[model samples]
Target chain A: MSDFTRDEIHRLALLARLEFTDEQADAFAQQLTQILHYVETLNGLDTTGVEPTSHALALHSVMRDDEPRPSLSNAEALANAPEQEAGCFRVPPIIQEL
Target chain B: MTDAPAYATLKELQRSLEAGECSSRELTQALLDRIEALDGKLGAFLRVTPDEALQQADAADAARRQGRRSPLLGIPLGLKDILCTRGVATTCASRILRDFIPPYDATAVARLRQAGAVFLGKLNMDEFAMGSSCEFSAWQPTRNPWDPTRIPGGSSGGSAAAVAAGFCPATLGTDTGGSIRQPAALCGVVGLKPTYGRVSRYGLIAFASSLDQIGPFARTVEDCALLLNAIAAQDPLDSTSAPVATSDYTECLGREIRGLRVGLPREYFIDGMEPAVEAAVRRAVADLAAQGAEIVEISLPHTEYAVAVYYICATAEASSNLARYDGAHYGYRAAGTRNIIEMYSRSRTEGFGEEVKRRIMLGTYVLSAGFYDAYYSKALKVRTLITRDFAEAFRQVDVIATPTTPGVAFRIGEKLDDPLQMYLSDIFTISANLAGIPGLSLPCGFTAEGLPIGLQLLAPAFEEARLLQVAHAYEQSHDWWRRRPELA
Candidate 1:
């Protein structure tokens, strides 16, 4: 059986950085429990010694030469900011004062 | 201009424009007027850019006068809202990016612009391309053009509806686990999800980076190929883009399918499928056989696990990709937050829809410390087995054929409350995305209730040319493409 409890879902929401109301969490927990149960069928497969396919293409470390090219200007980059100050994105205080 | 059938294919419009029967501006105006009349009922388009479209049309007309001709020149098309348009709002049908207008165009959109295609507007979709039905859209649910009470499949619901309702001749849609094909199937149009990396995903809002691919929706197979020719290209900006030569997809449309090998996957024709859908697909197979194509029975045993694997992989990627939407740089920011943590959490809570949140949570759970190996890694390993299943099957068959969807379009809100049931809607189409193969869905038949049924044709990776050829042969032999929904 899937073990998706409300508290587990709350922990996941915290990790995901999204706030969910109790009602939302409760409903999602139930649905997610059902989904987890459904996906648990994969455990029945004998995937021993099988390699994981992260991407369809097998290319590794696709890197271009270290060359600078045109990119979004500072004004354009800051254009979509909800709050901007001194030509930089303004955010809530990260380091709290003692 | 009024005499022109609004449901005319893109090729028909091209012919008319070339023959001087009507100017591009006149066609654009007529289509814009039609959208004004019909889209209110269909909810297919989130916005309509008449002024910009008309200006583009006028420029196309002048270029035509200067003896410059292109297949998509002066053609008006809608874009699934996920693609960023330079100065246009690129809402992925979510409240978060409700007013997020990008400063750049998606590479596909820019290529189409260069090919002279005119933009009608951004179309509706499942919020963040998360739902199979369009009902999850933050704006309004897009109704299927065939039947108003039914959903036009999604997250490309608006693109399919627009093509079906004749709001535009063609449109672009992204498929990550069947968004393009399912909707196209339901609406009786053609939708193609090219091989992953076949089309650049430079500016497409990520939904599942490995699986997401931008493709086209049109009334006919030929039109789909034409749109593909214009948009399929290698882009330096998208590192995953295959640096291979692009083909003129239209060149293969008229090719005969004689001596072609089509595989019927037994796993797809299982219980719970709508009888009408199965019957239509079986009939299509027979039709291809009659056209001198060989039919072979095949097995893709891992087909049942596609939904499970898809959910785990897609949600994991989506959880990571969507981390940028924390009310920091762009998109909607919630008010009344005490600290940065509260600000990030509250903004996402307010911005995303229930389905998006559900997937995000699921993704987080699978990728978490204790469950990572059990869920996410297991899913990735199963993904390899699934891909191997296709690779083995394709060695003996040129293309695999199946019913695009389990059933015809369901009524709005019919399956909304059941999330598991909703995920099963993409069972057949997900494997193609997972395996990185080209898949196309085209109208094959209609049910007794007059709902359209789709026949899916999937080709090996990068074998879109062969896939389109076989689909075109079947399409040319049928009268289904001639049928248009009577949208009152």
Candidate 2:
């Protein structure tokens, strides 16, 4: 991969749902490039036939009874909601009105 | 009880409470008072709920009077802020979730509560457990008790500091990438990270699901074992929690370590590592060899690639986990946004710290359509090699010994400027997390500058008992843990 350019960082900030200042974007371009450059040290090894390990443990699917159980109460679930209204999380309109 | 400063190992305190020399209420109040006086200088606690702690303490005392007993009964302990406590604010030291409270307890906290542990309240960490130092904490940076100008090694810096400062006998700290051990090493306490899935992560605000494990920081190895006994168990709530049977962790204490093979990896002794830290770890290895254990020089050939793998995996996981914090559902929300997308962007940019944004963006970049194969996928292949290296070494060794950190704790602002340097500093401790094995850090020695050096011990999966046993043996022969900062 090439060095991280500021425009690429800007695009990434949007993809990640974050907005960075011009200074932060530029700084990130440099810092992220450095971090990725160091991360490139892994390229020295030949892992041609090696399987990629996503999890170290050999985890199997867990099963449970299909019995009904009490989950969190509605009020409890909404307790930390930053914008709750009418027993639901209220949010700004996704579609702007003309 | 003797008229001493509030520094009693959990076992000693348990014996005192059992003997009826002092009531739980009195002991809890004394520790609260000590925290009141001392914790101002060391910001180990994010919140100190004396009233709630007293109520719990009274209940424990009543249970004791009624003939109830457990090892953790009436013992005051701190929780790392990352663990959710019912009605107690559980921020993972992030500004985004500063006002967040859980409606239920984390399984680990619940187990400890059932074992009659009193909550001394939450400890601080790096914002979302991201940074190497607690300086990334949204609230306050936890200062080292040994030298106030230096940082307490983090992201469980507060948990380590609280135990080392005698604010509490022990505290639970989560280690995804040496959060527990590095700080425990710097703060001069014993810290343990059990094998992945050994403890339930149901209510731990997840940083990385596959890597995070809740463990302990304590003044003694025995206290850590007692704590592990109370909390280490499978849970129906956390699917990732292994159904493997747990044993009495304390059973292995005081057991002879004769003929045990301990591996010393040459890669851990790098060129730029602090000489004192290396010396301390070598001295510990020599001490173990003197006690009839065979010391072998082993090769974990892929050791150099640990930090690279960890950053790729951990950041990728973190970016996904943190996606739930958009303005609509919970956590901080931005005001005056024209539409939802802008709201999400504004809320996240404002709510997150620089390190967090860097990681999220970096993670996004790696997982993006063009870069996955080059970065994330490549890192996973290297991860296999790292795990294989440990698996190969453990075949001939019972435990592996290494320095917990490359150096002693740095001055608070020293490495904060360079993100890459901060990430590289975790080189010694990140491998254990990557390999899903057990690792522990105990005070081995001190430097001329009076900073504590940590000696880390690694064991194969589910071999926490071995690490505790070996650490206990080393701890018994030395007085390193006996020394504390002159807090008075």
Candidate 3:
């Protein structure tokens, strides 16, 4: 089994913005390693000249007209907002700087 | 009601409607009532559109009165809440859009609406279709109708549960990986993930854009086919929708499976698969063989790498697709954000569930400056190998057969603590998504515990017709598709 350390797991958690306890982090480290090791079985293949297909079929080329359409009024749009101010969605200060 | 109409096949319901024994309004209200009765315990719907559904059912009854009827006419269906519906809440089961109503309808929604089908409301799902179990939804976990303590498989868990519970006759779901088929297999419903681009994705919230496709969840194979006929086709609005030939899928049903080469992947019968699932799947294969299908043991050697490669590629694409939800344009915005970064971070932090956030971070990491090739690019190369494996295997077999999941529905909290274990549940179904192949999950047998088990039938990409044919033949001989959850 691969040794996925607690530090690495914590780093990944940081990257992932997850607030995990130390115990949770340890568990995740072990689980992720096992899962990755299990999935490593795909490494044993010969994939020459086979094109990777992102979509099964070719999509239509046409684009819709960029015409103006009726839109939800600001009142209707924010009608369900948890919090709103001055016809806009209220939010915590975005950037402390800039 | 004669034998719980929810368990009846789409053809049976259509026949009943056509025979004038029951009006479309009656069926629609029956489902609405069913949802009202059980939704408190099941948590299947995020929103229930009783008034709108009644109005649409009246229209359908009027249309049928004039002898203008289609297979979908008067059918009551549910949306996965990920697809936009005009003036209806399309939350994607996230708090961000919990109250957000789209000003427009998705191509699939608009098509189904025009076909005279009634909407039963939005079904709960994983936040942004991210989790394999419905536990991840911001609302509440959708309980398996068969056993309330267990989860219905997910991120389309709500759709699968609703169909199995008879909350709606059928539902629309989006599969990006194994969201549709995996849950269907777990819940004992039929779910079809059409080959990518076969259906329009416009107005369906993006999860992993490259892997995502809108699909159907129904009570039986024929119902799935009927729904497919209504939804699948070219849509100019979605640039990625294929302009393919639209043949009625029902035409291919009820055909014999004689001479069809069914592939049994030696690799899919992996070490950890439960003995019960194995026995059930083997019995399905034997039954298919009895029905004159030739079972071939085909080896797709690269099957093992599917989960990792799918995670990497899917996450990378998701990172890009979800960048649109950065609190700028639409969706939920966290309050008191004075600046841009705080606005983006706080909105995302508040709006997305833990699983969705984790995916976004993993996706962001894989697509970041230094590690793209090691993770994303290499995964793409591995994806190519996996696809080639399917192509090579299909050369000898017309379709593939496998146990849809490693085991039947585990308890709701069984794997919730371990995300990796949850991810492994999709292993059998993900490769088809990776290869952009069409796959279906149909009820084959019940687990020894009496929960339903599903056998997955996979067809080469765009070969939905063949998949339906195989499923139809199986349904004819074995009437397991008629089984329903006995709710007290």
Root-mean-square deviation of every model: 1.0, 1.2, 3.2
Ranking by lDDT: 1, 2, 3
Total clashing pairs for each candidate: 0, 0, 19
Each candidate's lDDT (Cα)? 0.93, 0.91, 0.83
The list of candidate 3 runs beyond 4 A from truth reads A1-98, B1-4
Residue range B373-451, candidate 3, lDDT tens digits? 5567677778877888888998999999999999899898999878778898998989988888899999888976779
lDDT of prediction 2: 0.91
Q: Which prediction has the highest lDDT against the true structure?
A: 1
Residues B280-346 of candidate 2 have per-residue lDDT tens digits of 9999999999888999999999998899899999999889988988978778898898889988999
TM-score of each: 0.99, 0.99, 0.91
- In candidate 1, what are the lDDT values of residues B380-474, reduced to their tens digit? 99999999999999998999999999999999999999999999999999999999999999999999989999999999988889989999999
Measured with C-alpha atoms, the lDDT of residue B426 in candidate 1 is 96
Model 2 TM-score relative to the real fold: 0.99
State residue B481's C-alpha deviation in candidate 1, in Å: 1.0
- Model 1 error, position B263 (Å): 0.3
lDDT at B184 for candidate 2? 94
lDDT of 1 by residue, A1-98 (tens): 54667787788899999877788778888899999999999999999999999898775567889898999999999988899999999888877887
Question: Which pairs clash inside model 1?
Answer: none
Q: Which candidate order results from sorting by DockQ in descending order?
A: 2, 1, 3
